[model samples]
Target: MRLPEVEDTVNGPFTMIWSLLLSLFASLTARSVVNGQTPAGLAPKAFLSLPLGTVKPAGWLYDQLVVQTNGLAGHEHDFYHYVSESDWIGGTSYYSSLEEAGSYWFNGMVPNGILLDDPTIQSQVQQFLDYVLDHQDSTGWLGPEVNTTKPRYLWGRYPFFFGAIQMVEANATLTDRVVTAFHKFVALANTMLHNGEGLEDWTRTRWEDFVIVLQWLYDFHPEGNEDLLIDTMKQLKYTGDPWEDVFNETYFPKTAVEDLRNPFPVLTWHGVNMAEGLKALPSTYRFTHNQSDIDAASKGWDLLFQYHGRPSGIYAADEYLAGLEAARGGSYLYQVIGDPKFADRVERITYNALPATLTGDMWSRQYLQQQNQIAAKNMTPNPFPEDGPYSNVFGLEPNYPCCTVNHPQGWPKFISNSFVTTPDQASLVQVYLGPYTVSTMLAATGNKVSVSVDTLYPFSDTLTTTIKATKAFTYYVRIPSWVTNGTISVNGGPSRPVSPTNGLHAVSVHAGTTEFTLDLPSEITIEERPHGSVAVHRGPLHYAFDISRSSRVLAQNAQQPLAVDLEFDATEAWQYAIDPSTLTFHTGTPAGGQLPSPIFDSGLPPFTISVAACPIDWAEGGNTFAAAPPTDPACTGAVTNITLSPFGSTKLRIGEFPTFKAT
Candidate 1:
């Protein structure tokens, strides 16, 4: 029979009652384990640090949140307090509450380098986990009690979503011997199983949110129990939110509907879910081998690219469902979605929003988040002549408290999670700015391989990836949509056919393990975005020029352009080359052999980076494309030379380039 709906809501007294019925649902079985069949090219454990790089920040942040969940971390003064509950970071309270407690412990702790079976914090945590499991029915459903007492259906609480994340981490490795047991636990509550009804009352919604945990669950059960999953999705979509409106269909594929309400037409469903959905969809076709899913994901990328797209390469998702924009609505939705494209997106977004948010060590909140209906973005919190709009800077109290703590996780995690591996296939190495390695056992060939990529991207184009194979099998690399002409050489061998996808290139390696080189031709390409902006890029390194030979601060404060306008001034056109041939980095100062002329009397010196810069720099709050008051030391690197600053260090500079016209 269908369980009561309130089961998914707040964990009340019902939790204790249901906890007894679902124990078996959590015990999933384990797959075959190869005793010593370590694949051929698997790297020494020393190289293990490579894969750990991408996950460290995420793990660290989860750890910190855990500390805060338990009142262990946070600088007392920084601790967040709320009225709705005793304390909260916005509406979420990881303290005291069991569900958020479940979320905080598992989501933040499990992927955090701790083994599920580890004994350290297991006693107490296990009590809760085991308590929930013991009650799970054979149908795979396990929870406290249902709040069916109310009319509204339970969409889901934090723990359910966070639980999915923990599940993925467990199944990622073969050693997760306990995954099978967990599946059995899930089976009891699942509708497909005997006596199981489904997600209970919170039916017909929460497909993606549930997948947050399911992705992890699927990871543990490589050969998933499809019946339970499909059954869960079936009842949840009883009357799926109508995509009839262009809002849900043409826009982001449903970035969460609030209790069946589609209030705002503007889009803020970017980032987190965009990343998650992208991760959920397979490269070729994992689910049903269906092409429609692939096409929909692609379109979703486009829509996300349009509305939620931020000055940073990533898309924006306001607090929850706010439209994509700076100020009040910016949020961190794309963080866990696990899609490669989202990775690329956030990489770009960082260039813009991150710096803006961190004016100086946690001093920026450019994207505003508000719970109310009105638009109270960066503006002061004003209601009618009541609360003014526009927030100037960040202090102990910004318009919202949640985004403040959550923002720091973006950069460190992005750099860390840039790559991954599947049981059978692996992602192709796209851009390599330095040396890094990846390890995975491909299911197709039952071979284990370790790939080490060595190069400097966005700074230098040429990179080499060495493949160490335990057995002969294929691997792949991404050919970015940005590259028009580039050469790929295997072990210095002739460049061969690399299946080219229009958006991003994915090159597969049929021969076991070998080193490959990619030589790309440098040229100027106008970034294609709505904001009419033009940037010059040679290989991956974006080129920027300082119109000021005297200071990094522009002599002309002339308003910087909002977006790139390809129709830039011809006479004053910004161009560069391996000029003088010896110049390592391309940089240019004021045109007249020297800057700080009588022109300085003209006010802020006008300057702009070439089109070679990365695409994310054009939006506001991004790399100062135009010019800025020099507060950063790297801004001093803007001498009248052909050298460039590390994209990560150029603080206090203009980024957005406006269309220039000659008199």
Candidate 2:
């Protein structure tokens, strides 16, 4: 698709060079930029940030992604063909699957190939890219023209928006195609929105989707096309007024519990809407350069975290603002504002809610998952407001297929967005901790630096970063607030507690190789939850009650049964109360004291914790774990010892536990 080239409206090309040089020298560019500068002026350089395919997943994370590739992400196109409607990738109702496949291939398969140098994964990635580029329409629209005859009208083209972002990540050449398509679509969408005819139920609910992609394009554009980007932003309906209403009037987190009994419209309270909408205001902040817009984004998230925060650090929203639970959106928040708290939250969600909600093999997922969930089965009466009986089941389509396609994005994107460069392009920020490789261009020194981080993070407390750089550069490392006695040692330097500025521990590099060793102490902490219940935590990983389980294959395609689609039922009782005072933690292995095999395997956690507990009189309600544990449950038996496992490892285990006082 070829569209007329948009002219530069902001300034001439010489102005662009001057802006870049000024950014490097400007005193105001120090961690904080002057309030009203453009996002690009304050924006971290993308060249200085690691690309998606650079970092390859290892150990359990790699296994998870491969499982997805083998299952839904890799083979979804064979069973469900969305391109038939318009002979285009993103053409029919199944278009979301295509977007999911693109992200999965680019972020998962492509990167896996780079890390392992596997020809099979590499070939698959190239084939997908060719198909996408060759099939682009002349008008730039990737999907089918509006399906006017369908009963359910969704005017907002999410797959196109999502697929466009994937194209940006996949191939730079395809960006022009994406930009042109967006311009044509946005113009038509704007006309319809201005006349109050474009916004549909699902489209309005996810109106912020287009804004996020547009913001990415604007900052990415080397040429001065700010007007084209801003015009597209203004044209999108609800980009202005409706979203402002959410920032101001919609106290969803505060009122979500009350609204559960009396539900709100699903359009506003949907789980995915809340997850994706977290980026809406912050994305707009790029163009508006308004501090209020950014503030609103942070404030809204803060409220959501406070009122509806789950034990895993994911906010609650089942099908309709259920409660603090899974449908992971924590990483998106961290990406927006670069907050360490958000980064910590991302880890908690990634380690716990993300893997636990889906099967160990990453085949299926639960639509509504909670910190206290003990069962993953369909029920006549469930806790969720409007999800089906199969909402909690582990299957291909479970309750809704949205998660089948959407959930794979959680890990892949998290791995890709692990690092971001500062606005000056002199420093790099390591946000999410994991085993990966980072390659970036230091604009300040004109040096290309590559840092390889090797560690069993979340599972282990130590991380080693080995840097290969042309010259010296500053690397800003995140020191989580929970680590009071943490230390960052450079080249085996003296280990001492380092104070972080805005949660970042900065290290300056000299010419040649630099090695940094970070030690995070794992301390046992008991956190009090709703109704006098408590959650057990050791560093970032939460511990859950280890339970015996039995499985039955409800549905699956051709893949391995255990790896893809199946369901498990609790074979043992889960109604026990643990006494916090008797808690004793243990490392599973002796050599290096490393984690055991199958890091997140249910019933066989890598690490173990023993605690004295007694059977409780608590009962399940609405076929789910009781919303909150009984305030003080009566002990039913002797204080026998019980074994505990990491929250992510258990398939059907209790995370939040009822506490009983021992006499």
Q: For each candidate, give its TM-score against the true structure.
A: 0.53, 0.83
Q: Which stretches in model 1 have alpha-carbon errors above 4 Å?
A: 1-206, 212-226, 239-290, 316-347, 350-397, 401-417, 420-435, 492-513, 520-524, 527-654
List, residue by residue over 1-663, the lDDT tens digit for candidate 2.
Answer: 011121122000000112334323321322222454434432332223455565566554565566666655554444533222122344444343233333333434454444445566556555554555455456443433333354322233554455445546555776776566556655555555567554545555555667666666666752465666565565552322234335444544464543443222345555566665576666555555566666777777777667667776676765555553322115555555665666787777787777777665555667766666666777657566666667777777776555554455666777766777665677667777777777767777798888888777776678888888888666777777777588777787777665566677777776789887888876788987767788898877788886687777777555334334456667777888988988888865425544444456776555678888899887677654444577788898888888888888777778888887666
Q: Model 2, stretches more than 4 Å misplaced?
A: 1-49, 58-60, 80-139, 145-156, 159-170, 173-192, 195-197, 222-224, 237-241, 253-266, 324-332, 558-565, 590-598, 603-605, 622-628
Pick the TM-score winner.
Answer: 2
Candidate 1 per-residue lDDT over residues 152-263, each given as its tens digit: 2223333434433343343444234335545654454343423333333223222344543443455435355755654433322222221112233533433323223423
In model 2, what is the error at residue 579, expressed in angstroms?
Answer: 1.6
Candidates in order have lDDT scores of 0.34, 0.60
